[model samples]
Target chain A: MTTYSLPLSKRKRAVKTRPPRDALFIAAACALGLIVLVAVAAAVIPFAGDPARIVGPRLSPPSAAYPFGTDALGRSVLARLLEGTRTTLVLSTLAVVCTAVISVILGLVAGYAGGWAREVIMRLSDVLYSFPSIVLAILIAAVVGPGQAAVLSSIVLVTVPLMTRMVSAAAMSVAKRDFVTTAKISGVSAPVILFRHLLPNVSGTIAVQGTYALSVGILVEGGLSFLGYGVQPPRSSLGLLIQEGGSYMLQAPWLLFAPAAVLVVAILSINLIGDTMRDRLDPRETRSLV
Target chain B: MMSASHPDTDTAPVLELREVSVAFTSGAGAKRRTVRAMNAVTLEVAPGETLGLVGESGSGKTTTASVALGLKRPDSGEVLLLGEPFTRSRRANAGKLQAVLQHPHWSLNPRRKVGESVREPLTVARRDLSRSEQRQRVTEMLEQVGLNPAFAERYPHELSGGQRQRVSVARALVTEPRFIVFDEAVSALDVAVQMQILALIRELQAEHRFGALFISHDLGAVERVADRVAVLFRGDLVETASTEEFFRNPQHPYSQTLLEAL
Candidate 1:
């Protein structure tokens, strides 16, 4: 018989070799915090300059006066990048909030009801989930027409299916638990059981999925804007900046480099935080290693 | 060793399962197979009586409990709660029929306070009572189960296994239910804890005068609390007799085997 065992000294050494999980979580939080600070500063402070105004010579390299150089329009790249951060964050947050509300409701109903209602709702979501996310977003954006509203609608359409599926799965598992049945036996109303007993248990799943949806929403917004179907010109978005920067890639790579770097960091931070929350919120994951 | 006070035979049975049968079909097409979980099993619990159902695992003990609790619908036969057809209106039987499951953690919501759990049945069944009244009843129920009333504020995870079992009993009794199913209720506890809980169940049953279906595989536990013992084997009810008669002269070979194992 194989009895799994590990020496205490070896376990201790293994833990010592790597930074604690909490350290990585804190680092990611701080990185996202810095991005938010910059976005807010650009929105509130006049000193950050107008992102759309021509403030320097076109395609200028990084200089003391123009920290991230200038874009093809002779606009300050740093200012445009900060402004793009604010737009991306705000749009993605709004889209995710909408997705959370719609998906959580649908998921709970499908999971708890478990009959023809489940079949209808799950089948509808299945049809939505069949298409690739970006392709679906593009289709929705095309129908909606190019603008912030189009991008917002596209993000919600693309993200809602996955979020709804996740919440439904979580709710189904919780509904099968004995407490839900206990509540039923106690004569608690159906709505009360759904909201009180079922919802709180699945809230961890909602929080975790919300973070992933936020990241996906940001990426969808960037993709839509890059294709000229989102946030139109003069309104700086990280995608639009990168699209403009692509043309002057050889002459000045800073425009693409600056916005792309910030987007990557923001998504990475959110993903790390989501992972940490999953580990912390789930009681099963917190059990001591044998 | 039977108690002198017998169950009131004149009144209608508090709960009854008449020829109840349940079968589960799994898979589909050529692969389909049906498993008979319970085969026309009949039993009854009069007011203030405990009917012990002893069977090995997979012998339909749980299916019987499920049918009695109205959690599962029988393919054939009928269930009566307080002498009325159980399926007529579930709302009518809600708080009157409650259960304490094997695992306290399973029945008690981990996120809810003990008090809220005990008060839930009252909140549903006795809506006319004020919130303060419900709270007072909850406190009284907690104390009756041998726990401090203050323990009500704590979560299930904060209590020990035995204490959690006490909380489960408190939750079951809060509505002053006419019938409560103890499905392997004491089987999950330590031997010492089992005795304590069995005693608590007997004490509460005497005071409240409710009917009980005490299901377990442990013959010792059955002997301790059940007034009459029913034996099931392979979905078939083999024999039933009063506690003393069943222990002294088991009629069926399966019942004899079960006693020998004990």
Candidate 2:
């Protein structure tokens, strides 16, 4: 029994030196990496034939020559899917980055400068929060008209308030902490305290929220495009592809399956990655997996 | 009353708060009430002196320190740091003051390494010190506070409570400020650890000569370290005397009870 226990203890020690046993985290990370690689390739690389040109027979079934078959216009579904991936990623990423920057600034100002400024900023966010975000995005998109810019700004408008509220709450809690007061008492300038002390401490929350924003941005942009208010004609988006495929669902099932699969894959990967990052960044999450 | 231009201005108290009052409005509308946190509080700590401020919880000892530290502006009255008028709005004497607050766990930024925490004051107040000079001074200050130099590389959570408080001390002293407010600096530690910390504070004070306002509710602990003790009750200064005199023959009823309570 002693001999057997000795070897078992050694094995446990070996396990301790290995990376954490978080299967879900690993799977999500791989999925996210693959999706990002495809997005980057689609953005920079040209397909085998003109994505806009009719390069094959219409409604061709999935085969070696046409991996995802063909659509009604004889355009390769594979090429269009790639193009749509680029559109979805670039637009959503752009909107989320801008939203994150705006929200962080607004949050820091509202939190560090309490009193009338805080009251005004917080109330404004509350007003924005009262509106349904998707409905609000669509309303703004209609006013702005159809284009990538319209979709981007519409998403930013709806998402910025939510992100701002989150960041502001985090900033306010941190501001009340002793370290922040310590900084103020030491006579660290207001701007320095906001950036150096407040910002770094809240960065983990900001990052996790930013990741979640990417998923929201993609969903919002897709919803707008599906309703014919986003990406317009000539340009392609995942929602536009899915919409076009929806009409031919019975005749060409591959058209619906392919883009829908990518969309689901993209959104799921982003959410999972966000959750994993939140878990990893949290100081209290120390449960070792077997 | 001495003139502001007196020749001995340089020798004036390192920190002086005269009749400082602070009030806060709690609740809203019909239920609104103004809570007086401090009222007519007058105190001073001479250069190289340790003046202990003792009071019950909510008695406004911390409020007085806040005014002295320039963290909160007094509703009325004056604060002088190094004989210069001080307020939250004033920038002229900002970094000339420092503090080691209670709860060292919450005082230092957990995300920052201990070295950066120690060197923070220098980075903010003494930017003229070169990088190498700042690093050298941090190491020396850590040593003075009886902490290992290598402890600077560790995070605040990695250190024991006593070690973190010592790091707090090093951070407060790194700037070599004219005055510091130790707001219950030793109250949170174990009794044995508290003794070590008090000894280290005395040793450092002997070398640096920075006036300190030691605010604590622990009467026995205050007696060990304070040269002079001031008692506060319900936001008013009840008595101020040397530790020996106050303990020998207390004048105020509160002071007598405070001594007996110890």
For each candidate, give its TM-score against the true structure.
0.92, 0.89
Going through the candidates in order, their DockQ values are 0.40, 0.28
Look at candidate 1 and give me any clashing residue pairs: none
Clashes of 2: 0
**CAPRI band for model 2:** acceptable
Per-residue C-alpha lDDT of model 2 across residues A1-290, encoded as one tens digit per residue: 00011233554565467566378767877886887787677667664455788878999999999888988989888888888888888899999999999999999889888889888888888888788877887788778887788889977887888888778877776676566777776767888888877788778778888989999998988888988988885678898988999999999989989888988988888888787666655222321110
Give the lDDT of residue B129 in candidate 2: 84
User: For model 2, how does the per-residue alpha-carbon lDDT over B80-145 read when each residue is reduced to its tens digit?
Assistant: 888778654534565577888887666778778899888877777777889888899999989888
Off by over 4 Å in 1: A1-19, A283-290, B1-10, B87-89
Each model's TM-score for chain A is 0.90, 0.87
TM-score of chain B, candidates 1 onward in order = 0.94, 0.93
